[model samples]
Target: MKEQLVFATNNPHKIEEIRRQLGDRYTFRSLQDIGCTEDIPETETTLEGNARLKARHVKSNYGQDCFSEDSGLEVAALGNAPGVDTAHYAGPQRDAEENNTKLLSELGDRKDRLARFRTVICLIQGDTETLFEGVCEGRIATSPVGHGGFGYDPVFVPTEGDGRTFAQMKQDEKVRISHRGRAIAKLQEYLKSRSGADRPTG
Candidate 1:
């Protein structure tokens, strides 16, 4: 039987991305499907810490394998001001536009727009935890780019391939080169190698 994994997030987009990446190798479900409605604190100071915390929470609470990811945009010009605090850069409940505005305002007059997006993924099964990370270097645009992607996608242009930002890329294209995509690819490789192996029992 295929292993059932819970993605420790309420974001449908993220869950869909993960599902597409993993395909038939694993059956993945999100917090909503698992009836996890409780909001968890993301008070960690680092991306990896936050990813691990979310995965650990679902694994412990639901007694099932869980996966989680924490991603951020680090602008070199702003001293990485929004690295781990990407979600709350403006305020606890602010949306993407507000967060992007805050970031742009902080980057005033700074000509060096070098920045990178990082994603840390954590996979927890029982007491075992595995971590994977990926990064995409780019520069922050003076204004938003295409309107396709969410969060900070519109304001960042990658260092390779496309002249347009991530927001302009198709979903499959984005998944192929995105930081989260790269990280999840590593996990997929790991799982592919252990495809037929049995999951460790408690």
Candidate 2:
């Protein structure tokens, strides 16, 4: 029997991305899979706190080995103003287009458009709690370029990528160099080290 691991998220896009990246090494469960229809509050002021908050909540409620990830975009020019508030940058509505428009306006015609995407993943199982982080250095594009990814993907161009927004790339290509992708790679490494396996079994 495959070991079950609960991924703390209700977003179908994120679920799909995680599933695609992790493959079939273990049986993955989402919030909906276990009937958790409520919103996991991300009230923390930082990414790590939010990730841990969700992970601990799920483990406490469902008593399962689970993990949660928080991601954000930080612009250098804005002194990372939207570091943790990237989701609701515009207002409480958290509209993606409004957020994008706000970001562009704030960064209007700036020569230094440097920015980066950061992700933090918190894993909790039994009494063990571990945190993994990943950073993707890139710059903000002048406008939303593609319609592929979620959040700030439309206006973010990775330094390592071929001058295209993450939203313009394929899922495989995006995950290969994305902050979430890198953080997940670290998670996989840590799990492999803990279990001496190729991929995470649970």
Candidate 3:
């Protein structure tokens, strides 16, 4: 039987992306799957901190092997203004279109559009906590492009691609080089070393 791996998230896009990358390595569970109906607070000021916060919450309440990820877009020209606050860059509403507009307005005529997406994943099992990080260097597009991804995908162009925004690429193409994918890859490596890293070590 596949081991239960609690994936602490309510976002279906993220859950699907991660599940695809994870393959058949383990059985995945999410917030809805586990009846965690409330919006978990992410009161931290940093990506890693928020990731840990979510993971810790799941472990405390569910007593299960769980993991959480936090990611953001860092634009070099804006001094990384939206690092940890990428999700709420527009305001507390966390509207994606507004956030994108706000980012574009802040980046008006900056000339240097270089940026990157960074993701941090925190995994918890019992008292053990582990962190994995990944970064995908890229540039912010002049405008949103494509219709494939969520969040900043419409405006982010990875360095490994042919100048198309992340939203322009297929899921398989994007996951192979995404920051989240890279971070999860590291976690998978660690999991492999620790007996395939799944819950119910039963």
lDDT ranking of the models: 2, 3, 1
Identify the superior model by TM-score, candidate 2 or candidate 3: 3
lDDT of each: 0.85, 0.91, 0.90
Per-residue accuracy of model 2 over 120-172 as CA lDDT, tens digit each: 99999789999999999999999999999899999999999999999999999
Worst 10 residues of 1 by lDDT: 193-202
Residue-level lDDT of model 3, residues 67-178, one tens digit each, is 9999989999988879999888999998988999899889987789999999999999778899999999999888899988999899999999998999999999999999
In TM-score terms, candidate 3 sits at: 0.94
* Candidate number achieving the greatest lDDT relative to the actual structure: 2
Counting clashing residue pairs in each candidate, in order, gives 0, 0, 0
Candidates sorted by TM-score, best first: 3, 2, 1
- TM-score of each prediction: 0.92, 0.93, 0.94
Q: Pairs clashing in candidate 2?
A: none
The segments of candidate 2 whose C-alpha lies over 4 angstroms from its true place after superposition are 197-202
